[model samples]
Structure formats: structure tokens, C-alpha cells
Target: MGSHEAKPKVLILGKVDFAHDAWNALTQICDVLNPASTTREDFVKECQSGKFDGVVAAYRTFHSFGITGLIDQELVGAFPPSLRYLASCGAGYDQIDIDACSARNPPLLVSNVPTAVDDATADVNMFLILGALRNFNAGMHSLREGKWRGRPALGHDPQGKTLGILGMGGIGRNLKKKAEAFGMKVIYHNRRQLSEELSGGAQYVTFDELLSTSDVLSLNLPLNNNTRHIIGKPEFAKMKDGVVVVNTARGAVMDEAALVDALDSGKVFSAGLDVFEEEPKIHPGLIGNQNVLLVPHMGTWTIETLIAMEEWAMENVKLAITTGKLKSPVPEQVDLQ
Candidate 1:
């Protein structure tokens, strides 16, 4: 490149907590811009003021929702004509509106960190499964409140029990190995069945069979239009009595209210949830219930995983700026690539 040629501009929509080396390396190649606005409204106004007119690609973090809300139609429309790519620093890109991005005149290709999060997320999923099955939440609470065990109900063992997984993606496949170590049989249902090799000897069952037979059910799918509220009242009725439910996926994927009702009625023996319908604000029923194990969306809270995610997202930004591509483009925008 010649000194006369201007560096391509890239935008950072959130703070880079780690991966400073990667970010600094990116800055050496592309001119990086950070928004001064602290609120979504101000961010919009800043964009409208042409502060980011020349930004060609953007790297966003999930926490950046505070600065700029969902990357929806209105926000996408406010972006400069030069903006063409979005790199999301998380496995789930539910915060972004892929449709709106793709609808732009020269579509905004979006990428997300996928494999980088698999192990960390799957570890959390296994933790939830064990906690829920063992009914550890009640005992933990009891101990914290100065009571020893507090006469908690008997818990079930994972050994010889069937574990039904919904959406057998990377995390789900990783989870199967962990679950199998505990002597649990694994069954899964996905939009499309995986080959035997990818399935890892776990039986591929129909959706109905999965709901009906499993002693424990794990939700591992992404949150999208078709998947929102995928498990609700009717679906709960299909499960075996005394079944345990676990969700490490997005909250909206399972109906929280319906889950409360099921727990109250003893249809579900226990539940393990890492995500909620409205984060940081949980249903009173779940909070009051001793049978539920809850974690505040800390599936990938480890430093190593965070750094990997940040670096993966930066790689997307780097690829977008230098090669006009993304390292791991979101499934919806694969056609655009």
C-alpha cells in the first residue's frame, strides 16, 4: 500500500476487554473508530451526524446493546452507505437483525464467534444438567440459610437415564460426550439429522419422541423466528412425568411462564436455566421455586473463552476489511457471502 492510499475504516461498537494484541494489530491495518455516544439514542444521532460515514466494517459485543440497541432496520438505515459488514463477538447473533442487514442496498454481511465458544458453553450446559438432576439448588440454598440439606427431595441420578438434546450443533455434540461419561444415553433432534460420525452414536429421534421419552431435556438451539417459544405449554405436556428441563440457549426459546406453571404443577421435577426471558429480571415463580437452578448467563464467563471470542470476532473484522469476507459468517448471511 502507498502512503497516499487511505486505510479502510473499521468501527468498534463495544469495549475490547481482552485480545488487545489482535485489536492493536487490526488498528495497524485499518483506521478504527469508536463511538463516543453512551446511549442508543445518542449513538443514532452520532451516526446521523456523519461521525462514522467512512466505516466499512464493525465489531460489536453483546454488552454493547446498552450503547446501541438491536441492530434493527432503523439502526441499519442510519448506518453510512460504506458500512458493509458486522462482526458479532458471541455465538448467538440474536441481538442483530440479519434480515434488516441483508435488505440494505449492498447487504451487510454478519459474522459470529461459533467454535470459539463451544467448549465453554458445553461445560456450563453439563453443569446445569448435573445441578438440576442432583437437585443441588435446594440443598445449596438450604446450606446458605443455615440449614443442613433442609430435607430436600430425593434427586435422580444421570446414570442409566436418557438425555434428550434439542439442536445438536457444536455445543450439543460436545455435551453428548460429557453426558455419556456419566452413563447417560443421548438422543437428539435437529432440523436435519447429522451423519453417524457427527452424531457420535447418539440416536437421532423425531421431535415428538425426544419430548416424550427423555428423563432430561436440554435446549441447545439458537433463538430465531421459528425457534422462539419452541418449547411451551403443549410441548411440556408431551414430556414424561418427573422430567427435568435445562436451557442454556436463549430464554425466549422456552416459555418462562409455561415453565413456571409446569414446575408449580410438578410436571417438571426440576429445571436448570442460564438464560432468562428478560435478563437480570427473572420470573418471581422461578425465583421462589427451590427446584430450579439458575445462573445469570455466565456460560462463557471464563477469561480464556472471552479472549478467544474477542479474537475470533476481530478476525472477522480483519477479514472483512482486507479480504471482503468473514471467518464465520452467520448461517442466514451465507448466501450473501
Candidate 2:
């Protein structure tokens, strides 16, 4: 179809460009609108004036918090009266207010790309684990600043280390395979333990046991009410001293302030984080800390994975508009039905 042909009106609220083919596919199917290179205030104003049939809540789109907060809730309410479906490009929609959407008169159908992101997210989990254990942040900084760590002030190895995975989802399972290849033993705590075959012989333990036995702790869970600040001061105290912390999950999953405190007390030897509680804004204390390795929220951001996610999200959008059903709605949305 030509660009001028009638198509579902979609608001592309992406902070970053989509994979080229993904963008092409979207353009071929939807009439997309993007707010200019604008201020958050201006964007919020535009969002609040929503007039599109569907809204593409891109990886980082958000409504203002509360009455005027930017991000989920605010944007959810911003949907035009004609709105039918809202699809977020990423797996976790904790940033999007599913409850509010559920309460809408004819509730907006929502969806996300879940499985498509697993491989890349898992890769990043391992990257973070190794970086944290090896002190890659400090080492890289030292080298860049013209100082090498005389081979002694280096990092630890994953060999024979116990990698405790907090969430045993697809990403967690992939991380297990890779960690095992590096000679690390894996243990996990999940809401429900996987079968032995699914777990590939990785031990399953209670949360407390996972903490005590883990030499390196990796967080791969979602962010929700129960999961918010799940790893706080008390949880930190329970962990083995010098445990390396790696998070490819949500930032709020770990208490950033509490983590810094643990780092200060020499409890957590180091940390590698890809997501932050208040993302794009690092905790003031974490900046300039040599023990922490921080990356922007780019868990599933490789070329291949990005294309898969974008295409999956668009597929959901297409199905929702055509059949009034989503292929992969969030679990809570499924429960509601």
C-alpha cells in the first residue's frame, strides 16, 4: 500500500529510531505521527491532546506521573476517544499502567514483545555479570586515563562461582547456559521452580538460600508492585559478602540507594546495572563510583533483536486493530479476560 492509503493512525512515541526494516513495515501499515525534537513538557502537551486511533508507546514512551507526571498513567489517559489499541515495543510494561487501561470504558488492548527479547537480554546479563566481577568499569577507566592496574588490582573470575539467578524466565535460562560454559555453577529462585529438564540441572533454591550461596547475584525479573525495591537493605545483608550484583532487569528491582550503601560497606564487591529506578538519571551517589558499571537501558538492543522486537510489537498492533485481540498481551491482561 502507498503511504497515502488509509491506515490505522499510530503515534510513534519512540526516543530512538526503530530498526530500518521495522520502521518501513510500520510505515507501510500505519499512519504514524511523532512529536518533534521537543521538550518533555511539549511532548506531554501533545500526548494529552491525543487524537490517534492507536498509540505506539515505544520502548521509552511515558506519561507524566500523577496529574502531571510524564510516562504511563498520564499517557494512558491521553488516548483519544477513538483509541483502540496501545502496544509498547518492549516486554516489560511496568512503565505502562495496565490497570488504568483496564478500567477504560472499552479498555484499550495492550501488548508487548516478550520472547523475541530473550536472547539479547540474556547476553547482556552475562556481560553485566562478568563486568561486575572483573571490575571492568574501573579497569576501563584506568586504562583510558593512562594507568594500567599492574596486573594485581584486577577483577575476579566466574570459574567455580555460584551464579544465583533471581528470575528463571527465558532470559534467565539463556544466562544459565552461558554461565555454565564459563564453569560457573547456577542456582535460581523463581515464583515456581522449573522442571529439571527446563532448568538444565541448575539447582533450585529458596530466596534465602539463593542469597547465602550465590557468589554472584543476577537480577532478571520484571518491575511491579511486589518487585519494586525487592532487593533492599535487609536483602543485601543476607547475601554473601563480596557478592557481585548484576542486573539486566528493571532498575527499581534493586534499591539504588541501598545498593550504594552496600557498596560503601564493602558488602557487595561490585555491581553492573543496565536499568536504573529513575532511568536516564543515575543516582547521584553511583556516578563516579569505581565499583559500579552502568549502561543505559539497552538490554535487547542489538540489530537482530531490535528488529525482532519492533516487528513483534507491530504484529501485535496489527492484530489488535484487525481482530481486536493481541497475540501477546501482558499476563495480567490475559487474566482479566
Candidate 3:
């Protein structure tokens, strides 16, 4: 059949209220179908049946059995080859198996709303930093237990302190602005050096130099082969004694066991985490540490960020319908490639 004669059958493989009038705008352009939930059987059946032209993989609910600690292959096995494009409805594609998706015949087009998470991520990073500095988690629990004190431990000031960023992506740039606003000396280490003009008062530095000189460090790099456990015991040992650390990036980006040890030994003064190596099941040692602050992976949970992400994700899906392409295409070097 001719392309114009055949309408694309777009399916949402996760729970999304596309039925909402505002969200249904795309339905006017294609035959939209959203199953309340997608099981392995359902996904395979749809693909084998040649039913869908594109799919919006909602990252929030698109977890496979492996990620959920269920059977691994079963969840991944459900993906249908019928999908020409997969639109990730969030800032990151960590949930979707991009490599497998790209191996398809036409090469699945993977795209994400990468910009929407910047403000929210910056806020969360800042929250973690302040919480760690003030020992907020410990003090809050103590206060709830009626252990009132004249004053809690003093917190470190960001002003005039060296702030180091592990990666200088969108979130890192936003954070650099925030750090500079507080008079913190910002420095960073990235695989590729950004132009000096856009470094946001952040000096380019060697990884070791960043670790040794910074009073505070925030990791913003993507999780990949070279970066997995990028901050382990060896890296931690290079940092100044009593340095503060915060991670708002992917969980596995740091070595949880090493971080716990640093906290215990006072090699690190305090740490804050919005993500973990094994999410939902954080390292138990950090749980009881008075020097650590933990959050349940809420870096991009703000209302504005969610709305912007959903809208941009829908726009990405719409691009496939109109041009047979994706706007925020996953780079060829990404795992999905």
C-alpha cells in the first residue's frame, strides 16, 4: 500500500493518559491505541501481528522484568519489531534497551526529551548538596524523636569553595551557573573539553585535580562502559579530606560500597544521592550513615519538568508520523546504536 494511503498505528506500550483531550491531539494524526498495560505476550502479539507503526515508550512505566528484579528476558522479549520509532517520554533512556531496539531491520529511532529535566535536576542537585552539608536527614529524624538541641552541627558554605563537576552536559552547565552564583569556584573534567566561552566560570581540569581540589563534587556524567563506577575507592581516596559529594546522575555511576566506606572512615565528610547502583534497594550501609542524605530518585519529579517532558516526548513521536524521523535521535555511539 502507498505510504499516504496507510495510516500509522501508534501504540503506547505503557500506562499513559493519552485519552486526555490535550494528549489526544496526536490521535487526530494517527490511529492511536494505548493498552492499559503491556505484557510480554501482548507486546509480541502486537509486533508479530504487524499492528503498530510507532511507539511511545514511557520511561516512567516501561520497566522490564530484569529492572524490576523479575525474570529478565521475558520483559525485553515483548518488544515488537513493528515499531519504527520509540519515543522516550523523559529526559533519559536508561530504562529502554536501546541497543536491542536499534538492531531491528530499519534501525529503531530512539529519541528523548533531554532538555526538560535540566531545571529539576539542578534543583535536586542543590537540594542534595544543602542536605548533605547540614546533615538534614539525621537532624530531621532526631527532631522527630524529640531530641531537640540548641543547634545542630555547623554546615559548610558553598561560597569561595571549589565545586567540581564530573560531566558537563546540560545538567552540569545549569549547575555550573548555580554554583557560580554562590561565589563557588567551579571546575570540571569531561571526556571532551567544552569551549572556554561556555564553561560557565568552570575551569577545565584533570580528573585527579578535580577530586583533590574541590570542596564539593557533583557527578553529572552519563552511565556508560567507561563511566560505570567512575567514582570508586581509588577516585575517592584522591579527594580532599572531609569533601562533600552529590550524585544526581545514574546510580551505577558511583561505587556504592566505596562511598559507604568513605562515609564511615570520614574520608568524605558527607554524601547525597538521588540515584543508586541498585535502585530502590540502596546500599544498606549508607542508610544509617549520619553523614549521608538520600532521596528516592526524584531528580526530575517537578510538575513543570514532567509537563514539559511529556509534551516534548509527544512532539518527538509526532515527528515520526510527519517525517518518518526523530528529532532527538540517539547518537550512533549510544548503546542503542
Candidate 4:
């Protein structure tokens, strides 16, 4: 590299809460740019104004959605011609439109932090499973209200129960070992069956078998067009009576209204949810149901996980500027490498 050549520019789409050292180090190699606009409208205008003309890569956080909105066609088109890489600081990239990014002339390659989040997210999934199966939420709420040992229904033990996992990805595989530690028999359904080693003796059942036979159902798949509302009224009707439902994945993956209906009809015994279809605004049905245990999307909320995610995303940015390649390009854009 010639000393006279200008340094490549990198953009920060959201605040770097941790991993300050990595971010600081990145500053030495690339010119870092921060957006002045807070709203989506102003952001688009700012981009069109050439304030980000030389940005070649960007590091974005999940919370940055409030600032830039969806990274759709319009927003992607507004980006400078020099921009080529986008590093998202989370496992799920549903908020981004990969098709739109691919359609661009030079193609905006995207990467996400995957293995960094598996343990934390799986921990939350296990927590929800235990809370829902034991019907602990009602008793906890009752005790909080000064009631003494209110008559909560008897809870089912994880021992000998069938745990049906949808999506045998990293989080699901991690949860399998944790649930097995509680003596639960695990079965899973994925887009395709896993190898014998990866399956770890867990049965790979069909989708229908998973729904109809399991005592507890856990959703851990990514959200996409084919997966939106994948679990709805018709699917719930096939489940065993008094089935426990748990979701730590994207809220929209399962139909919120249908889940409420299933609970109301006594088809589902209880539910534990970390994500909702419309987050920060839960459905009234779920709120009114005493059998439901809810957490506000805290799957990867731990400090350690956040730091790892930030560092992983920064690595992607660093590699993009230095090597012109992403450490973990999204599956959709593997050919872009």
C-alpha cells in the first residue's frame, strides 16, 4: 500500500457498546464514519448528499434498525458506489433483504455472528422450556401479589418427556444436550436430516411427527418468507393435547394470534415466549393468559455474549477492509466471495 493512497472508509451503523479495543484498532486502518441522522428519512437523505461517498464497509447492530430501518432496495440503492460489505452484529439477519443486496451492481456482501451467540441463546431456550413445563409463572405471579402458595396446576417433569425441536441448527443442537441433561428424549425436524454424528442419537422425525408426538415443542429456526407464520392454527391442531410450546426465535416465525387461540382453546397447556410477533407490544390474549410465561426478547442479552458479538462483527469489518473478503458471508451470498 502506498503512503500517499487514502485510507479506505468504514461506517458504523450502531453504537459499539463493548469490544472498544477492537473498534479502536479498526480506526487505525480505516477512516471510520458515523451517521449524523437518527431517523430513516434523514439517513436516506444524508446518504444521497454524498456524506458517505467513500465508505467501503459498514458494521451494523440489531438496534440500528431504528436509525436506518430495513436494508431494503431503496436504502441499498442510496448507498455510495464504494460500499461493498455489510457486517451485521447478530445471528439472525431477517431484518436485512439479501435479495436486494444481491441485486445491486457490485453486490453488498453481508456477514453475521453465528457460533458466538449459540450458548447464550440456547440457555434462554432451556430456561423457557423449564418455566413453561413446570407452570412456574402463575405461582411466581401469585406469590408476588402476596398470595401464599396459590393453587397452581401440577407441572410435568422434563424426565421421559419428548422434546421436539424445530431447526437443528447451532442453538437447537446446543439445547438438545441441555434438555437431555434433564432426562428429556429429544427429536428434531429440519429442512434436511442431519448426519448420525450431528444427530447424536436424537430421532430425525418429519414435521408432522414432530408436531403430533412431542410433549414439548421448541422453535429455533431462522425467519424468512417460507417460514413466516409456519406454525399456525392448522399446525397447532395436530399437536398432542396439553403440549408445551416455547419460542426463542423470531416472533413472526410462529403465528401469535394462532398461538393465543390454541392456548385459549386448551389445546396447548402452556407457552414460554422470548420473542413476539409485534415486539414491545404483546398480544392482549397472551397477557391475559396465566399459563403463558413471557420474556422480552432477551435470548442473547448477557454482557459476555454482547461483547463477543461486537468483536465478531468488528472482525468482519476489519477483514472486509483488509482482505476484501468476509469472515462469514451469509449463506445466500456465498457465491459473492
- Per-residue lDDT of 195-250 in model 4, one digit per residue for the tens? 99998889999999999999999999999998999999999999999999999989
Error of 3 at 325 (Å): 2.3
Note the Cα lDDT for every prediction shown. 0.95, 0.78, 0.74, 0.94
Q: How many angstroms is residue 302 displaced in model 4 relative to the true structure, after the best TM-score fit? A: 0.8
Tens-digit lDDT track for model 3 on 134-180? 66877776777798643445677777888899998899999888878
Return whichever of 2 and 4 wins on TM-score: 4
The reply for model 2, stretches above 4 Å from the true place, is 1-7, 26-30, 33-50, 53-74, 150-154
Q: Per-residue lDDT for 23-76 in model 2, tens only?
A: 676577667776663565666666565544355333233332222243456656
Native-referenced Cα lDDT, model 3? 0.74
Flag the better candidate by TM-score, 2 or 3: 3
What TM-score do all the candidates reach, one by one?
0.98, 0.85, 0.86, 0.98
Rank ordering of all candidates by lDDT, starting from the highest? 1, 4, 2, 3
lDDT, residue 115, candidate 2: 90
The list of candidate 3 runs beyond 4 A from truth reads 1-6, 17-22, 35-80, 150-153, 333-337
Q: Is candidate 3 or candidate 4 better by TM-score?
A: 4
